[model samples]
Target: MSADEGARHPEDITVPDAVSAPDAEGRPRRVTRRFPLFTRDTARPEGSGRAAPLDAPAPARQWPILAVLSLVGIGLLLTALDVFRYGTLLIGVALLGGAVLRWLLPGVGMLAVRSRFTDIATYGVLGLAIALLAMMAQPDPWLEIPFLKDTLHFTVSG
Candidate 1:
């Protein structure tokens, strides 16, 4: 083989027939190719899906979730305002309420941020933890959680 032919990669060898013909203006009209990320089946259908685009107005059915989240926000606001006692209690209640809502109404519109199982597990665990911690808070703890006082002492000391 000639040196030129030997040096050329297989992919570099283009078929003459596949080359674009010259256009009326004498410019080589190349064919442009497009590869879409999603095919017809993979593409999201309009007006049908679990979640809508962020710009769209929220559905009316999501009010319950909004209310629950509002309560949680209020609780956090109270905590920020230095009312630790009532604030913490409210926060716990909100989290527990969220979990209950998730359980009872799986199709709770936008409130179903994640899978039903995940939402329930997260809300329940966090709510219970907060409630427990609030009950065991210092200065004048309200509820006596068995062995928690000793556990906290041990963890804190060592």
Candidate 2:
């Protein structure tokens, strides 16, 4: 036989785990285990094998905010029914509650609510001022005019 004839035998080479190996029955058996995306780092074997945990701690519980929000919702319902004379006060309380939450727990507070309450309070105060001014300027709608005393009829025709 020549010196280079089949010198490298197939049995001498080491095949990776992904390649199927024959079982005792001479049938190829599948390799179930998956290989890592990257080869292991030679410098640190333990660090390369495991990854750092990424899960964060649970957020702290906030109960006062829930209670205040519930109270504000109930006040809003009463104001909507027209049974409450202090509707603005109820609305202000709700807005103030949101503001307090935002101030106390900024991470948990809704950003939209905080921004909206700022504008709501500003415009609400202005609107209340204008309404008061109008009320002071005009006479009551129930009062009668002197010039058209005889011509005006009290009864409805329809």
Q: Pick the candidate with the highest TM-score.
A: 1
Model 2 worst lDDT run, 10 consecutive residues: 44-53
lDDT of 2 by residue, 20-112 (tens): 878999777886576544544534211121111224322213343454566557766876887353443554565555445444442432222
* Candidate 2 TM-score to native: 0.29
lDDT of each: 0.72, 0.46
| Deviating ranges (above 4 Å) for candidate 1 | 1-59, 155-158
The predictions' CA RMSDs to the true structure, in order, are: 12.6, 23.0
lDDT of 1 by residue, 30-85 (tens): 75354333333543222123333456577554665677788888988999999887
Model 1, TM vs. native: 0.58
TM-score against native, each model? 0.58, 0.29
What would the C-alpha RMSD of candidate 2 be, to one decimal place?
Answer: 23.0
What is the Cα-based lDDT of residue 79 in candidate 1? Answer: 90
